[model samples]
Target chain A: MTPNILEVQNLHFHYPDGSKALQGINMLINENSKVALLGPNGAGKSTLFLHLNALLKPCAGKIRYKGADFEYHKAFLKSLKKRVGIVFQNPDHQIFSASVKQDISFGLFNLGYSATEAGARVEEVGEKLNICELFDKPTHFLSVGQKKMVALAGVVVMQPEILICDEPNAGLDPGNYKILMNSLDTLYREGCTVIISTHDVDFAYSWADTIFILDQGRILKQGTFDQVFKDRRILEQAKLKPPWVFETWEKMIDNGMVSNILPAPRSQEQLYNMMSDRRIMKRTTPKIIEYQNV
Target chain B: MSPNVIRIDHYAYMSPLRNVHPGEKIFFSLSTMLLVLAMDSILISGIVLGVMSLIIVWRAGVKCGYFLKLLAIPLGFLLLGCLAVLFSVSSEGADYDYFIKVGAVFIGVSVDSFWNAVQLFTRSLAAVVCLYMLILTTPINHIICILQRLGVPAIIINLMVLIYNNIFLFVRSADEIYIAQVSRYGYHGWVGQIRSLSLLCSNLLVKSLKASNDAFNGMISRGFDGELKFVDEVFETKAGNIAATVILNCLLITIYLSGRV
Candidate 1:
């Protein structure tokens, strides 16, 4: 069994403007899992991530990292921050240095690495992110996609155990989107627990092993995609649509076009394969369609 | 394809001397500037301006046209300053090489004052060229690093870095806003332009505040720890760099002693 890398319990938070941002949030994120937080705008996804990274103290509840409660002492917060890196959505906000290499090295230096070691590490991360050519590029001249990659490089070099990204996929073109996803997959395979908050249902459906549906400052449901998404009520309440692949697969199954399957298909290729299973001409169980109705 | 606001910085990053030790560049530029100011020789100042401009265009990869445009920025102010030295008003007009009498006073240019103004103008121009060489060859972070090594306070250095980073962003933002306003005929008339400029300024103030707040949060998320730390760019001092600095300064000293530019 995988260890729970991060746990949030009954967390409550409010903005200084007297608006509730997060309420009674509980979560269990295991090591090496790809988790996606899905919600509409103003649903408190970013607010929740800030809490997870220890950037914000919850108003009513507490968080634990690796089963140890978070202590707000200076040293403890510093250490915790080094291990849990948060990549903000805007690269401009994150990149404070005019030089790309300098910006990327900011985190490594804060972690107390030596000059030679930090330089090598920054170079290595640049190569890993396929931004090697941009090492000496000025941050201001970079395209939005390039800046986003640079921002990701800065945080990823810290080698955080749990990397949280708020809308990492925002503003990326198709080519850069593929590259970013590939890099995230590479990081995940290398034993980093990657978490992202995105408005892309198709991306979350196909990529994440676990999904947390957030709505109105509350978690509507948290489970595997099939368990959480199979229940249409929670998705509707959360103001999200089912991924296109799942939606099509479900409609075909409703028309007696596929067999009863335990786990629903998450991707287009998976749905295609499921369609050609040759045994999929049978009707699905009423348990799913009936449950989806209610 | 980059914006015009960071044109100098763009040249700096792309400079062939970019990877050279900042200490060497800083030392060379500062020494040259001081010599130009102290010698007060028109010939030496001309030599300094010519050599620096040549290096900036040929070695630094900046276009000559842009370099001249940058040099032209202070031409008006320099002329105005030189004007004060060039013209003298006197009741007698005794020492004047040429004089124009206006009412009871004569405004004239004297031979000595003419040489003095020429020297002053050339010296100031040479000093500015020397500084431009430093700016065009070295990125700001390196300058900040040099200051840090020289024991500049952290607060000031941090402020410099933050301001440096945000300057380009705000320039681009203002440019974009200007274009957006122009699209709607915001600057069609003087009154309209004033109104548009006021609106843009107010809008920018709010946006800059938000951007700074967001930047602060971004830094905090990265374990900022009330300090800004970074891995200084790696540069190795070579014998060639040291020798070049020595030879260059020695030649300048030789020219000063010879009283020939």
Candidate 2:
């Protein structure tokens, strides 16, 4: 649908010990959509990511990128990998270069860019990521936030159209997390498809254009935040709570403050404005209506 | 084991030696070791050792005792050198004119052999200390950078990099092992500790393998080709670094030549 950039058809994946990591599943990611893959621990969110870049082979399904089946072709898979860059959860595991500059240039070198082109790309991304100070510094010496930034810069320099990051904000400080989210916004604006697997519900609600709810190796629901998270039963089944803002909106709706919750406000400004509207007199009436049980 | 070892990685500690290229440091070490090995007499070695020690103090600002503790490692050589000179002296070649026995006791030994041993021991010790300062003060990355600039094969440089990385990884593994043992029963006793030790060893091996696999995955994901293309090339060498390195080399050469006697 909507010119899917990534199409997953009835995928199944299993570990060597016969543990299923991804049950029979199907999904499609529209071009330029910033999506979040949300799930609890052991929910196979990471396994789903590995399949995106062809890092983990599918057991019984096909992944097609740009309308080309990538199931059997090695060259296609390699090209797919180049197009879809995955920033791993562990920055330490991902960063193998001696210096920040080298780490960024690593992918470009692999992509067979000329020395001049790779160097230019490295400089550009290093500047964009605010890592100009770290270009010469050793990777090991960098702080966790700096390391993650360096790792992200490394992947970004390759100019991938699709970015799939697994738990990118797992150990981030608020400042670094905001910086990363801002960068993701920037990347989305640049027409890159951004996919983040996260447990940060607020981040997903605020940032993602589409959200995929994963549970027990399956994608149970996929839609805009309002569509996926509006169902409290589904939320409970997935073992996740809706974002605080979403919860507030639901409370306002049950109190007859509004006829319905405005489609999960994507920004604080939008939520603030919608709540403060005087035209909705019902919203102005404090404690006027009984709130509904979820 | 010392906090200083960790602190040594900080820039303030390394600032003095950062100016010298790793190749230059290696060269100085080689020359000093050669001079120590080639010397036949103790007097020349002692003077050479003294000169080297003075240069280390002047350049690196390191203390004599810190280095002496390190030199304590090769003290066996000092003992052996002294013993060899003492026992190998030809009876006919004895320089002492009077074999004086003070009341049926031969108490005094030849001064020549004793001085020779002292010279040999101190000179070799000094050389190692200078090299130690060179390594301890210069960052490993800079050293690798210098080596790359000096036209070393990319493969060799890469191997050195992997080895350096592995040492840190090994340290991390050791730390994890220690924590795991402490968490489970608090490292109680020696014999019972076998379980923890074995677990640590196995876990370390597994982690190393997993790390290598992850490294391979990262390399593949990032488009790592065979040759390591430098992201940031060494554009220029600092004048102060070059000047210091040249002066140190000159001083080392002078000490080495003086040690020939």
User: What's the lDDT of the predicted structure labeled candidate 2?
Assistant: 0.71
Per residue, candidate 1 scores C-alpha lDDT tens digits across B48-140 of 899888888888877887888888887789999999999999999897999999999999999999999999999999999999999999999
lDDT of each: 0.82, 0.71
TM-score of chain B of each: 0.89, 0.62
Candidate that would win on lDDT: 1
Candidate 2, true inter-chain contacts retained: 0.00
Q: Write the per-residue lDDT of candidate 2 for residues A1-294, one digit (tens) a residue.
A: 468998889999987436899997788899999899988899998888877876667888888897888763545644765788878787765665456776677566555578899898889987787889998887667889998998788778877899888899979999998898788778889999999999988889988889999999998899987788888888899999989888877777787778553465666787788877766425443557888899
TM per prediction: 0.53, 0.53
Which runs of model 1 end up more than 4 angstroms from their true locations? A260-262, A282-294, B1-261
Which 10-residue span in candidate 1 chain B carries the lowest summed lDDT?
B180-189
